[model samples]
Target chain A: MTQTRLVEVRQNVLKHNDVLARELRIRFQKAGVFVASFVSSPGSGKTAFLEKTLTKLRSQYRITALVGDLATANDAARLARAEVPVKQIVTGTICHLEAQMVSDSLQDWDLNELDCLFIENVGNLVCPSSYDLGEALRVVLMSTTEGEDKPLKYPTIFNTADVAVITKMDLAEAVEFDLKAAHASIQAVRPAMQVFEVSSKTGEGMDKWLEFLQAKFVDGQV
Target chain B: MHELSIALSIVEMGIEESNKRGGAKVDAVHLKLGRLSGVVKDALLFSWEIACQGTTLESSRLEITEIPVVVHCENCKTDRTIAEINNFLCPVCNAPTPEVMQGRELEVTALEIIE
Candidate 1:
């Protein structure tokens, strides 16, 4: 009979992804580019928000985006209308974007020429929480129409996110979106988390969000 | 969902480690899964079975130890295990405990192998 022995491995299951992410972080820092990744559920207006951001920031700074989807390059086509370079990462059946995919898609581009690079993760609140994409900032977006209890329902995403953005604020009143309750929910899960309220369509509250990004970019430079 | 991919990774790791140990057959994989890790235990177990098929770890069992969320409560000046993920307030002082001390672990702590 064979003998069984227990060996202490003590290794993180996602160590491979984590190592790749670390290498990407170092590369981004050396190139002086601020990388921000966006995560949210489907139909949360991620594409619209990114389009608006790219359009507004392209004039002042060189910006680009890499959008991920399960099967379609539609988001890439939409973002291209912003007149900035865009790449689409079709994950096929994969629900979330991994660091290796990001690293692979970026082989052709020079990171030094870009001021900011946004990775719009495949619309998912759960799976994306576990993978780190070597981004300087991880922004979690929740549209006002999604309801106030989103943070409570998906606490892990909120906890891992560096900042939160409440999009589609222009329709807040129509949806009867409780702003106070939303703030309370976000605070309960992630205390002192910086939040921005903006409507990508009407451009309301966009200036403040842009200013915050500008501040972060400046900080990254130093 | 993403657990299948994660399970595949675990199996790959197990095979690699076993190969390094003179191709010993693995009996079980010991994992520490945290509450805030965002992976469902049932889903991961289901995926593990499928991921292990046709591999060296085909018959290996996955033993998971669920870890609870622990946060540092500033008001109490100690670590507290919060019961609910929605409410992150300290049960003792009712203060917001934003600093999490533990519960994000998705690590393979050990492996049971037969020589």
Candidate 2:
């Protein structure tokens, strides 16, 4: 006697969370909330930059942020002072933040209430490049002290990013930061990428940064 | 560090593939990992054994084939393999290449299972 066992199994590798992320993208699009995510190595001043950005844009637009860290809600607490609703996703030991986590955490908040949402991804340049967080834009951050070869060292992340922000420009001279080399490196990976140089401490280049946000959300409204 | 997550994905995919063939236990999974895929081979192999514990891919072996980065030079009109990741310019013309023909791939190509 011969017996046949019928089995039905069809699944995508990232099936479980990708579906939720897709739905979240739809929700964000419908509400006209432009989402932006930041990625960089640890201690690249991501939170500090976001704090300044959120503080400046809070009055102009309904802004909220979701920050991710391996542990602690420190960034969330710091950003809440800007008076915009903020949440932190503690990824435990995870190196990178996934899209599903963002969707799950923001389930309680009304998407229409906010004009823009920023997701500060877990600070890692390499791994975060592979995962899409359903954001309208992805910005890669790098500080002057981290050296100018960062973009070349990690081209994948630089290539995936829509924009590159050079942080801590106030200390550029102290660290002997090579702006030309840095720009060249980024251009090599992604030519014609929009690059922003700013220092959160001195508020240098904040105007351009703010204008960018306004244009992206308020004027463009895409 | 993210190898564990990748290993989990491999296990999940292997389990689903095995289940499709009448729930046979997977013996191994073949993966084509490119040299510039940004995935550390040893780290992934180490994480795979641990990630397979209490899973359908517990006995599965991970076979990896490393593919070299190949780039097409518009200036020279020739395809060449880059021996090092840091070298981004074409060897003959010294011009920067735009299109990378091969490498930088991470995928699960096939699975071996036994009934």
Candidate 3:
């Protein structure tokens, strides 16, 4: 029988992605662009919300986006209607957007020409939490129909995000959504997490969200 | 769903590490897994076998050391172990613990191998 030995391996499993993310962060910082990535469960209004954001902020900032999905570029097509540079990263079976994907997608683009860049991750709460795409802000969306216990059930997602947006608030009343309970649940998992309630259709409560981005672009740290 | 890819990454990392040490056969990998790491242990375990198949880490085991969630309470001025993962409030002052001191680790600490 061969004798066994202990190998000292003090490496993080996701160190490769983390290193790439740090490199991307430096590149984005040098280019003076503020990056924000959106994450949500399927059908949580991420596309609609991003569309509204793109349409609203297109002229103010030289905006561009890279949207990721498991299958089609349908969401990218939808976002293109906003009349900004929008590309789709078809991840196929990948559930989250890694730093390498972001790096590969930005190969031909001039990052300095843009003021802000957004990455819409593949609709997932769990896996996306583990990977960082070099985003200055990570936004998580939860629609009213998804229930108030969502933050409680998927606490890790809430913990990983910088802000949470309650989308489709126009249907809140129709869905009998308890706004108080939802806020309480978000607070329960992530205390003092900035939460926004907005309806992409009606554009209610969007001004504040837009204003928040404006502030970030101006005062955002590299 | 994404656990398979994560498992594959872990296997790849393990293989690279073991190969650096003169192509030793990996016996097991020790990991520091925190509760708030967002990785499902069962799903990861299920995917490990498939990810390791035909790889250098093929029969190797994954040893996970679970780390509990610890939060720093501003009001209490002490780090407290969160009793419930959902309710992130300080038990002493009922104040929201805004700081997470631990429970988000995902590190490969060590490996057992044979020459």
DockQ of model 1 vs. true complex: 0.87
Candidate 2 lDDT by residue in tens digits, B16-112? 7767776677777778776666677999999989988987778678988788878888888999786655556676777776567877667777676
List, residue by residue over B3-111, the lDDT tens digit for candidate 3.
7887898898888877887777888988888898888888989998999999778888999888899999998889999977789999888999979999988888888
Screening candidate 1 with a backbone cut-off below 3 angstroms (N, C-alpha, C), the clashing residue pairs are none
Off by over 4 Å in 1: none
Winner by lDDT between candidate 2 and candidate 1: 1
Q: After superposing candidate 3, which stretches have Cα over 4 Å from the reference?
A: none
Using lDDT as the measure, the top candidate is: 1
Docking class of 2: acceptable
How accurate locally is residue B35 in candidate 1, as Cα lDDT from 0 to 100?
Answer: 92
- Local distance difference test scores for all models: 0.94, 0.82, 0.91
lDDT of 2 at B113: 68
lDDT of 2 by residue, A1-222 (tens): 434233223333455556766777788889989999999999999999999999988877888999999999998999898888999999999888887789789889998887999999999988887677888889999999999999889887876788999999999999999999999888777656789999999999888987886788755454
TM-score for predicted model 1 compared with the true structure: 0.98
Q: How many angstroms is residue B27 displaced in model 2 relative to the true structure, after the best TM-score fit?
A: 2.0
lDDT of 1 by residue, A1-222 (tens): 899999999999999999999999999999999999999999999999999999989999889899999998999999999999999999999999999999999999998888889999999999999999999899999999999999999999999999999999999999999999999999999988999999999999999999999999988741
Better of 2 and 3 by lDDT: 3
**lDDT score of model 1?**
0.94
What are the clashing pairs of model 3? none
